[model samples]
Target: MRIARWTVTDLIHDGFVIDDRVVEFPDGLTVADVLARGLSATGELYERVRDAAATPLADIRLLAPLVPAAVRDFVAFEEHVEGVSAGVEGKSDVAPEWYEAPTFYFTNPHTILGPDEPVSPPVTERLDFELELAAVIGAAPGVGQANLTAGDAASVIFGYTIMNDWSARDLQGREMKVRLGPAKGKDFGMSLGPWIVTADELAPYLDADGFLAVRAEVYVNDELVGEDLVSNMGWPFPELVAYASRNSCVVPGDVLGSGTVGNGGCLGELWGRNGSLTPPPLQTGDIVRMVVEGVGELVGAVGAHVAAPQLPRARTRTRARRR
Candidate 1:
C-alpha cells in the first residue's frame, strides 16, 4: 500500500494513497504522527483510515512519508563512484578500495523538505542535484548488528521514496579530497515524497533477478542531462543495508539514499570536471526536476539572492585535489 502525508484545509494529515485518491486517517495528522507512533504496528491504523476518503489529491500538499529518526545516505553505486572519480579531470583512476564495502553519511534531518518546495541556493554559488532512490527502515531489530543475509535485509525494509540530495558542488570538491565523507556540501535541503510505497506492495517492481529496477533522471530547466538505472549499481540495497547495519542499528524511518547516478548527477559534471571548462550555472528561476521510476518526481525552483553589502572575505585556496 502507498502511504502518504498530506495537507488539506490548512491542516496536515496522514493517509493511504490508493488509485490516485487520498484516504485520510482518523484524528488526521501528518504521516510523521503515524511513524512517531511506531510504524511496526500501524497496520490497524492504516485499515482504520483505508476507506475514509477525505481530500482531493490536487488540494493537498504531500510530505515525506516518514520523519526519520535518522537519515543515512550510502555511496553504494560503483559506476557513480568510478565515473565521478574519473570525470574529475586529473583524477582518472578510482582507488581500488572504493569497492570494498558500502559507505554512508549522516545528514541533517531538519533540512528535509517536500516535493514542490523551493530550494534556496547555498552561499557557495555552485548548487547541484543528486537523484537517489531511498529505502526506509522497518522496526524489526536485528541481532548484534551482524552482517544480514539478503532475506534478513529484505525483512527490515519498511518502504521506498525518491530523494533529491541537494549539494553544493564547490564545497564538496574541496572537502571530499581529504578522503573523509561529504559534510557541508550535503547538509542542505533535501526533497522526498509524494508517497512511500510499502515493501510488500513494491515486490512486483523488483526484478526477477532480485534487483530493484528503479531509474533515476535529472532535468535542469527542461533539459535532460542525467539518466541511470538502479540496476547498474555495483551493490544492491540488501548488501548496503546489511553492511551498514553490521555493527550498528538501523531504526524505523531511517533513510538510506542510493547515492548520485552518473553524467549530470551533479554540477561538477557541468563545470567541466574541475571547474576548468565553462558551463551554465543555475540562475534565479531555474527549475530542477528529479524523477525516479516507480516513485514520483520532485520538482524544485531556484530562487533569487542578493550579495551581502560588504562582508569580510576569507581565503579560499586549497591543494588537496579532487576525489
Candidate 2:
C-alpha cells in the first residue's frame, strides 16, 4: 500500500492511493496521526473507505509526503563515500571510522519538496542531486519500539521513500574544508515523494543479507546518467537505524536517508569517474528525476537563478574570512 499527502482542487488530504484513485482519510487524520497508529492503520483505514468515492490521481497535487520530525542522512554506502571523498575531498579512501558505525548529519526538513516542485539552485556553478532512500521511523503494526537493536531495525521501519538530497557543490566543498559543514550547502532544498511504500511491501525483495534488491536510477532531462542496486549499501538500513536509535529515541516521523548510492549516483561522484573536470552544474529549467524500484520516483525542476544579495554588516563573515 502507498500513502500520499496531496491536494485536490481546494481540499488537502493524507490518504491511500489505490488503483487510479485516492481515498482520503477523515478530517484531523494527519500523517502524524496515521504514523502514530502504526502500519496497520493504513490497511484498516483503507478498508473503511474502499467503497467511497476517490479523486483521480491526475487531478490531485502531491505534496512533500510529510514534514518529518527530524531528518538524518547516513553515509551507509562505501562506494558513494569512497567516490565522494576522492572527488570532493581528494581523499583516495574513506576514513577508517566510517566502518565502525553509521555516520550521519541532520538536514533541514522544512525545505522538503514533493514531486513536480521547482527547486531553486543555491549555486548554479555546481548544483547536483543525490539519489537516496529514506526510512521513516516506527515499524508497521505488530512490532516492538524502544531499545531497538540493529537486529530489529527492520521490525520498526514504517516505510521507505525516494530522496533527492539537492546540493551546491561549490558551497559544500568550500565549507567542508573548514571541517564543519555541508549545512548551508545542503538544507536549502531537497525532494522527497511520489509516495511512501510500506516496509511490508518490500519484503519480497529482501536478500539473504537483508538488503533489498531494488534498482535505483537518476535521470536528467530524460537522459539516464546513472543506476545502481539499492542492495549495494555496505551498511544496510537496519544498522543505520539501529545506530540512530541508540539510547536516544527515534520517534514517528523521524527520517533516515540511505545517502547516495554507488559511483555516478550524483554528478560529483560521476566526476570522480571521468578522470577529468566536473560536468556543468544544473542550469535553470533542468529536470532532475530519481527512480527507485518499488518506491516510485521524484521529479523536480531548477528554478531561475537568483543573484546573491548584499546582507547586513554583522553577517559579513560569509565574505570577510580569508582562507
Judging by lDDT against the true structure, name the best candidate.
2
Residue-level lDDT tens digits of model 1 in 1-323: 77887777667677788676788767755566555444556677777766775566777788767677788887766656655665464564456777787778889888888878777756766766777888887666562356677668877777788888887777778888888757777776788886787777667767767778777788888888788787666677777778777767666677888877665676555454554534466667888888878777878777664343565767787767895
Q: Per model, state how many residue pairs clash.
A: 1, 1
After superposing candidate 1 on the true structure, give the runs of residues whose Cα lies further than 4 Å from its correct spot.
Answer: 27-45, 87-89, 141-147, 178-181, 270-279, 305-323
Give the Å shift of residue 224 in candidate 2. 0.7
TM-score of each: 0.85, 0.91
**Candidate 2 stretches greater than 4 Å from native:** 139-147, 311-323
lDDT of model 2 at position 124: 52
Q: What TM-score does model 1 achieve against the real structure? A: 0.85
* lDDT tens digits, residue span 130-242, model 2: 99988987544323345577777776788999999998888898889889988878978889998888888998989999998899999999988779998888777888887
- lDDT by candidate, in order shown: 0.72, 0.82
lDDT of candidate 1 at residue 249, scale 0 to 100: 67
lDDT of 2 at 10: 62
Q: Which 10 residues in a row give candidate 2 its minimum summed lDDT?
A: 138-147
